[model samples]
Target: MVSIGLKGLRHLDQKPTLSKANRNSFTNEYWKGVRVKFIIQAAAGGISFMLLFLACSCYLYGSLYKSHQRYHNFRILAVDYDGGVIGKALSAAYEELKRPEFPTLYFHSPEDFPTPSDVYQIVRNGHYWGAIYSTKGASDRLEAGIQGGQAATVYNPNDALYWVWNQQYYTTFAQSVVEASIEQLVSAARAAYTKINGTQAFPYVAQSDPDAVQAFLNPIAATVANVEVDAQDSVFLFTSISMVMPVLQQFFFLLALNGVSREHQLYSKMSVRSSMIIRGVAGLLYTFGAALTQAGYYWAFRDGWKVDGNQFVLTWMVLWLLMHTHFTYLDAISAITPISRMPFAVLTWIFLNISTTISPLELQPGFYYWGICLPASNAYSVLVTIWSGGGDNRLYRALPIMFAWWIVGNLLSMAAHLRACHLAYKFDKEQQNNKGDGESAMGMTPVGSEVTIRPHSTNESAAHDDLQQDKTLEEQDLEQRQIYGPSIPPPFA
Candidate 1:
């Protein structure tokens, strides 16, 4: 009852209308200095921070995984079971496999057989992805039925151990050698049969019956003709850069907004002030634009690194516009919480933690899509298109989805920011009156008046001001005590 009565009397303590107008004029004068200072400070700090981030990013990505490249030469060991003739044939076949650039090859005679377990262990420990083993069972089968015998047996490590690049060529070369051997044996058998009979022997069917030949050859031909590997090498790097760049950019926006929310907390009436609103929006846009420009420049100059530059640029622009707008909306949510900074900081950290999988757009789609929906996901998509030779069609298809997400996220954020701003200001006069004073006729410094408005930035004075609001309340107490006989009684007490 006493607090309510005091609150009722507090409004009667407001400054008269004429003095209020004069104070307004003074406040305008005070803020001209404030605006000029803030504009300079914000512009300087924003540019400095952006450049530093860009420089660091460029240094990190410029080499593009050069450290993992394998330059040391290595050798492959081959074991031959056949005598000199078969051995020579095997050697020729091995050499053929090694052609177009041999790493190194060492041939071992058949008698020096390593046990199967030892062979497996050696291959595993030897850093060798390839090895071939022949067995006597294959030779005996061939001798028993020269024209219809099983081909020589060769054992290899698990398919996972196969060298990705050499798998197809190696298979083709091995089949060709088997066919040549079969043909030689069959020809010798036909000659021997004719020599014994003194004329031609009964006709034997060929392995290349037309129907069988077509069934085997047709699909293989189509597969080779239709399957394409039209990938550029730099797609991986470009996608990587894209995935990480958005995360860095969003982090800057989140932190900067946290600072803005702090400023609003410092002065209550400033929430509804049009100037504050404009500056808040403008500052956010400026930072967002700066980050976007840096990302775009990196994208454009990426050179033959990625294709579809213009498409990527368009997609990215629409996507970021949505993202920054959504961030503006989220500003309110951050401000209303007791510790607004913590949520944004933690969320940004979480997004970054999950962003690694999509860090490069050029990765195979199977891997890229796994974690691509994270903040870096869209950026990775745009980058992959550029790196993998996509263009306008892909951008047109993708940007709408990104734009929709951006819109939805911003809408939620904006609603929260606006409501929080309103609530923060609503308690301004109440909080002020609750201090050691009844209330000033002027009401919490009328925001811009008497308040030394700095640039909407956090500097030493601002930090000090944050902890120093009691001085403003002190002045109000002195004025109230002089006029009202000190009945104010420390409003809380």
Candidate 2:
């Protein structure tokens, strides 16, 4: 049956010149159908693309809207251990400070955080975005050093105020908001100290106690300790492209796979299950290599970066999982989506993923919280953690999120493949049924149906074959006539 169908379609594989009558008939009878097909396709494609892109564009645009205004959502702990003149001045200044965009500081007593080092631990632990703490006896040490007249050795002004934050969390926010607020706190303390010491014998202190004068002027200098600093400058490139590179690779592979499948007629030639399995395996293999190559590239250019073997493996594993998740999801979506609309899907995927990572969720509006659930967010969280040595340690939670996405994506792809197989089977069955019915109407034998398809008698079969031969010859002659014109047909004869 397949051989017969191919033989019948052989002529359609070749281009033939059109006669005047054939052209008129095609223009009158078939052209309208073709035009209507294109029209419906254009309208549907345009409308759907516009709606999806507009919604996605709005989502990405709105994701970070008024981000600076949401700065107060970030919490920074303030521990005033210096319960003397400096601490009192800092406390009063902290109260009077009012910057709407600045993070609201939560002040705690020195008793809450016994040692100044505890502030670094809490900040690195992700308890708060940052911490502003003063050391014990910051004021007393300064006062004693001032009175002794040779107290420069005992008094380190930078030790008076310490701001602890992790730059690895989000460098922009860490520097702009968290550090900015810390600077303001330090400035407030400075103003308050000058107010307290204005009446003192400044000339006497300046001459006899040069150290005290220096301490008095710069009493509340800040000691910034960025616990989770980036490993190297190249790390910025490594993490920034983490989302884009995988997605681009996935898109390119899917497109290439689709093109190959269409050219080879894989879907029509192979069973649906077999083809889908091949595609799935191919995607996994490609992602594996891609992940390895990407990891190798980073390793090659580490530029003094270092990590344990386990961490290195985990980084590669995260990349593999992330790429796999992206591939399976795209494969499933592409199975149902038209090729023309795929560009829009890819763009939407990339933009939505980047919108979440470009800034921290705490800085963005609440609606962007779902961004954390996305694969890019989790994968990036794990990657940055690996690169920065130790960040918020979201790996405990992010790894599982990526794994879940990979599992769900594979399931969806499998289901879509099954649906495709079912649809293909139905289409083949309908074509066979229609062929049997048409042949029966022509009083000829029909092969392929188990029941109700009439087979012609011997005489009827012979007559039908002769008639088909005659029709074939007639078509050949007509096509030649159309190509060469009636007057030039002598050459063929």
lDDT of each: 0.40, 0.73
* Candidate no. 1 TM-score: 0.37
Model number with the top lDDT: 2
Candidate 2: tens digits of C-alpha lDDT, residues 252-324: 7876776565445455568877887888889989999999888888787766565567777877888999999
Off by over 4 Å in 1: 1-237, 257-267, 270-280, 299-303, 306-312, 315-319, 322-333, 336-375, 386-397, 435-493
RMSD of 1: 20.9
* Superposed Cα deviation of residue 466, candidate 1 (Å): 21
TM, every model: 0.37, 0.75
Estimate the TM-score for candidate 2: 0.75
lDDT of 1 at 19: 40
Please provide, for model 1 over 1-493, each residue's C-alpha lDDT reduced to its tens digit, 9 standing for 90 to 100. Answer: 2243555665643535434545654247677778878888889878866765565444334322332121112334445443322233334544444432233445565555454333334443323323443333332332322222222122111210111111111122212332232233223323332343212112321233443222212111000110112233343443345444544555456555444444444334554456346645764676467556755765656554333557556555644653464354344344444341333343444344234332232212333344434444544445434433342124554456567656666566555555645555555565655452423312334555776434545345544554465446666544322211112122222
Query: Which pairs clash (backbone N, Cα, C closer than 3 Å) in model 2?
Result: none
